[model samples]
Target: MHKKQKGEAAVITLVIVMILVMVGGLFFGLPLWNRWRAGIGGEAELRQAEFNRQIATLEAKQELESAEYLNQAEVLRARGVAEANRIVADGLGGPDGYLRYLWIQGLSKGSTPQVIYIPTEAGLPVLEAGKR
Candidate 1:
């Protein structure tokens, strides 16, 4: 009877020890698992940040190219206008020639001015249609 009681007490102590070891292992392993999951999430966030930066750089490059093209087009348009003005100036002999061209252009129109002043050496006035 004494030996049987000793055996039963030994078995109970071993079972309790096993339960305590299992609880301690779980307590220690939970933090390590949480840290590993956080590391994975952090790595994913870093990759997303890099992707966003690359997209921003690409957009800036495209915008710069568009601006350069617009500037070139504006310069070309201005040069064309300057060239046209030079050709017109060459066709008209001088200031008086340009004035004569304007007079001819006005005459070609249907409407005429009632009082017209023609520039001469003395600045004389020319009457249109009927003038008193």
Candidate 2:
């Protein structure tokens, strides 16, 4: 009878240990799994943000190149006019003003331009028909 009682107590202890282990796992393991999933999601969001920044930079560069090309074309046209007329026209109605106007228009349409601004003494020079 003493030996049988000892065996039964041992079995009960084993069963209690097993149940405790399962309960501990239920409490701890699930949270760890959830944390790992959240970490993965955060990493993916960071990667996506980086990709978006790169794309925006590429787009800005392209727009700058376009603006530079347009500026060069305007300079060439001005040179041609100067050679033909023998008098440099005065005022913001010249090539630079026209280019700035065009750039502003493009920017308004969501196109970034390389030459962001034309510098003047106080601020941007006002466009006029005839002025120095």
Candidate 3:
């Protein structure tokens, strides 16, 4: 009976020691576990920020390319207008001839009433010609 009591006492002592070890580990390891979780969260945030920056850079590049294309189109349009003006000038013979052509065109439209006056050699309009 005495030997059996001793074995029982040893088993009880072993169980109490295991409980104490578990408690001590909880007191020390909780902070380390929290820190590890925080590191994971921070890495995720960094990855998201990098992705946003890449998107912004790509958007800016696309805007610059669009502006370049618009500028090229404007340059081409301006060149075509200048060439058309040069051809018209050559066909009319000179600036004076172009002006005379414009005057004749305005008279042909006749969208409104206008006073008719014939110009003299001195470049003065003969306003009294209709009365004679």
Candidate 4:
């Protein structure tokens, strides 16, 4: 029938228009998608910086706690050493107190001893010393 052919032509035109619209949308939407992808990169960088800041803060706290514990251990060590020295001094009475003398003697071992004289008073610089 002649009417049927005209209806088929209209349907063909409608299909063509729909395809053109879809192509236009594909072209126009490309830049929008690119912008969204660029924004995601910026958000990722911001999140990474926030995580780094948090990690640094936690590390600093840990370092401070470690330093505090180290100082406490050092204090305990010094106290123990002093107590042991006191006990040894009590056992030896006056003999254990000569450690300084022993250390000075150790420095002079297997070497000749030297003596030097020092002036008791400082003199003024010579103003008219003769020069050759």
List model 3 lDDT by residue over 36-106, tens digit each: 99999999999999999999999999999999999999999999988887787679997787778878989
Better of 2 and 4 by TM-score: 4
Which tens-of-lDDT digit does each residue in 46-69 have in candidate 1? 999999999999999999999999
Determine which window of 10 residues in candidate 2 has minimal summed lDDT: 83-92
Which regions of candidate 2 deviate over 4 angstroms? Answer: 1-23, 86-132
The TM-score values for the models, in the order shown, are: 0.56, 0.47, 0.58, 0.63
What are the lDDT scores of the predictions, listed in order?
Answer: 0.85, 0.81, 0.90, 0.80
**Candidate number with the higher lDDT (2 or 4):** 2
Over 4 Å off, model 1: 1-22, 94-132
Q: lDDT of candidate 1?
A: 0.85
RMSD of 2: 16.0
Better of 2 and 3 by lDDT: 3
Ordered from best to worst TM-score, the candidate numbers read 4, 3, 1, 2
Residue pairs that clash (backbone atoms under 3 angstroms), model 2:
none
Give me candidate 4's TM-score against the actual structure. 0.63
For candidate 4, which ten residues in a row score worst on lDDT?
A: 112-121
Measured by lDDT, the strongest candidate is 3
Q: Write the per-residue lDDT of candidate 2 for residues 10-37, one digit (tens) a residue.
A: 9999999999999999899999999999
Question: At residue 118, what lDDT does model 2 achieve?
Answer: 49
